[model samples]
Target: MLIPLIALAGVLPAPALARGMDEPRASLMVGALLAFAAVLAALALLVQARRLRRRDMQLHARNAHLAAANAELREVTERAEAKARMLDGVLAAMADGILVVDAGLRLAGWNPRFPDYAGVPRRALRIGMPLREVIRLQAEAGEFGMVDPEAETERRMAMFHNGTAPQRLQRERPDGSRLELRRTPLPGGGYVTLYTPILAPAAAAAGDAMQAAFRQEWTSRIPRLTAAAADGDVAEARAVAHALRGVAANAGWTRAAAAMEGIEETAAAGALTQLRLLTAGLPQDPAAWN
Candidate 1:
C-alpha cells in the first residue's frame, strides 16, 4: 500500500499536487514511513530468533544432565552385578552346608551342598519353604530317630519357636554318617546354620575323633592329588595339595601336616618336580594315614 501510494504521488499532475501537499514534501513523508515499517519488522524478527536460540540451549543442557545421570546408574549396576557374582563363587566353593532363614524361619538362601548335607531332597527345599516342612521331610526320612514322624516335627517346631532348640547339636544319619549342626543368629532377624559332616562316630578323645574323620578323606583324595600332578595341572595339583595339608593339620597328624606344608611351599615356588615327588608318596590307603 505504501509503495502504491508513493507511485500515485509521483504520477499525480502538477495541478493535483498543488491542490494537496507538494511533491517534494509528500515523497519525503512516504519514505520515512517505509523506513519505520522496515525497522519494526526487523526488530520483531530479531526478538523471535533470540527466543528460539535460548530454548535450544536449555534443551541441550537438560539432555546432557540426563545422560550423565544414566551413565552413573549404569556404573553402579555393573558394580553390584560383579559383587553378586563374587559372592556366588564363594558359596559354590564352600564344603559345609549353609542355610539362611528369615525371622519367620522361612528359607531365604542356601548353597549347593546344603541339600545333601541336611539330608533333605533337592526338590523338597525351595526359597521361602517353611522350617516345619524341612523338619517333616527329615522326620519322614527317619532322621530324627524312630519316633513318630509328625509328632517329632511338632516337637522340634515348638522348640524353635520357644528358643529352646540347641544352638549346636550332633546327629547321626541312618547311613551311619554323622553331621554336626551349629546355628548362629544373624545380625538382623534371621539364622544361619552350618552342617559339617563328621566322617566317623564321636570318640572320647578329640585326637581319636580327628584321626577317624581324616583317614577316610585322606584315602579318597590322595589318588586325585597324584593324578593332577601327573597331568601337569599345576593349579589343580596345588588346590588338592593345600586341602590335604588343612586336613592333616586338623586331624592332629603332626608329621603329615609338616610334610604337606613342605609340599605346598614347594608348589607355590613353582618347583613342579618336587611337587610330583611329594605327591608320588601319598598313601591311597586309610591304614597308612593311621
Candidate 2:
C-alpha cells in the first residue's frame, strides 16, 4: 500500500517537474511527503493496538464474574443438601408417625414409623401420591371400621382440607389401640401430620385412680412421719422414709424419690435435725409426687 501511494506521489511530482521545478527542490518535496506518510501510519498502528488491549481487559472481567457466580451457586446447592439431611435425621428420631404433604396435597415425605402407625402396608406410601389416596387406603383396611369406606374417605379428606378442622383428634383403630392425630401447617404452604399411639380412656382413668390412691396413702403416712419427727424416733422416721421412697418410685417421681432417699440417709445416720429439714422440703402437691 505504501509503495502504490509513493508511486502516485512520484507521478504527481513528475507533473510538477513538467510545469517547472529544480532537482534539489523536487527532492526536498518528495522527502517531506514520505515523512508525513510515515507519521500517519504510526498513529494508525497505535490506535489499533489500544483497541485490542481494551477488548482483552473486557474479556478478562467477564470470565472472572462467571467464575464467581458459579462458585456461589455451588455453595448454595451444598447448603440446601445439608439442611435436607438434617431434617431427615430429625424426622427419623421421632417416635410418632410423621407425614409431610405439599401445597398440592401430594405426599412429599414420611418417616419410617408412619406405616406402622397408619396400619398401612410397608412401602405403600410413595412420593407424589395424593393424601386422599392414603386416606382411602386406610379406610378400606377398616382403619375407620365397617362404615361406608368411600364416605369415610370423603369425610377424612374434607376435614384434612378444611382450614377450620381441629388441629388434634383422637381416633380408635380396629385393634383397639387409640391414636392421637395432629396436623400442622407449614410456613410456605402444605402440612405435616403426626399419628401417635395413646392409651385407651379406660386405661388412663385407671392410671389416674391408682395415682390418687397412692397419693392418699402417702398423705396418711405423712402424719406418722410428722409424729416420728416430733418424738425424735429414729426407727419410725426410717420406716416412714422407706415407705415414701417406695411410693415415689412407683409413681415415677424421680425428684421426689431422691428427696426421700436423702431423708432416709439422715434418719439412718441419726441426724434428726437434718431429717426434719429434709422432710420440711417434701412436695405438698399430689401431682408433684409424680
CA error at residue 280 for candidate 2, angstroms:
36
Q: What lDDT, from 0 to 1, does candidate 1 have?
A: 0.78
In candidate 2, which residue pairs clash? none
Candidate 2 has an lDDT of: 0.78
For the record, the alpha-carbon RMSD of candidate 2 to the native fold, in angstroms, is 18.0
268: Cα error in model 1, Å? 24
Q: What's the distance in Å from true for residue 48, model 1? A: 2.9
**Model 1 per-residue lDDT tens digits across residues 17-89:** 5559877887786677566666766676788899999999999999999999999999899968965774565
Clashes of each: 0, 0
User: Which lDDT values do the candidates have, in the order given?
Assistant: 0.78, 0.78
| Model 1 ranges off by over 4 Å | 1-20, 23-27, 200-290
Q: How far is candidate 1 from the true structure (C-alpha RMSD, Å)?
A: 12.8
TM-score (C-alpha) between model 1 and the true structure: 0.60
